[model samples]
Target: MNDFDALQAVIRRLAAERQAEQRACEAFLNALYHALRTASGPGLPLNNVTFDFTPDPAERLRPPPPGGWHAAWLRLGLCEVLVRVRRDEGAFVGEYGEGGTFHLTGVTEDDLILLARRLLRDVAAAYGGGGLVGRSGMPLN
Candidate 1:
């Protein structure tokens, strides 16, 4: 197989091996969500979480780029129901060639669910028709 195909095969294998870990992570996020809901005194689920993608975000928005940064926007919410007040918990990102990984930085389950829901929506929309969206925060130096 070509290098790209071989790399994809390896990635798929690694992903399969990590399935259990991903499930556990999801469970942990769910627990956190329940606790937040309990403390909040009742709630269904927050659909407020959003994914803002741009070829490049404002210099202020990006963390230091590692491993040849790729154009992609990502936001992981774990208790972001509070928006600018609390903060999204499980957010992370990476380049497309690098295999985007959703790093759950262990935020409240509520935030995780909210963030996941939004991401799922974004994924669906991306494949539905529109090619990957691109935007620029500031022109690359």
Candidate 2:
């Protein structure tokens, strides 16, 4: 084919790949949200945490905030953590309060749970230390 046609084919391929990536990101975020929401048990740092999905999962068609295409907010007491899928890296970006930023890579539900647990630990550390407790009165530090 002509050079113009070749470029058009490349553009089409890139567009399709980007769209697939977006879908994958969305699925990943949704699964993560559910995993974190339902997680519970003694000694779990997330017991006192509040989780919220940006644009809500039902509103996926809506545009996302400038921070990321999709986000999960984890709030504990006064500390707030934001988790989002990085468009460029395709990894989960975890940001807590001011300067605590981390990247978590995972693809399965189990991986997401581990990622959430890790985020909670970091958030607890950022919040202060050793004061987080579950309903069972167990220390989570």
lDDT by residue (tens digit), candidate 2, 18-131? 566556666766676566654554355445556665643423533432233555666655665665564556565644334444465656767777655655665665557555
Report residue 25 deviation for candidate 2 (angstroms): 0.9
Error of 1 at 120 (Å): 25
Query: Residue 93 deviation, candidate 2, in Å?
Result: 7.3
* Per-model TM-score versus the true fold: 0.30, 0.49
Q: Which ten residues in a row have the lowest lDDT in candidate 2?
A: 58-67
Pairs of colliding residues, candidate 2: none
**lDDT tens digits by residue: candidate 1, 1-141:** 999999667667666434543444334434433443343234654444343323333233232122212232233343222111111233433222111124445565565555445434434444464433323322111
| Model 1 CA deviation exceeding 4 Å by range | 40-141
Q: Give the Cα-based TM-score of candidate 1 against the true structure.
A: 0.30
Best candidate, lDDT: 2
CA lDDT, candidate 2, residue 136: 58
Best candidate according to TM-score: 2
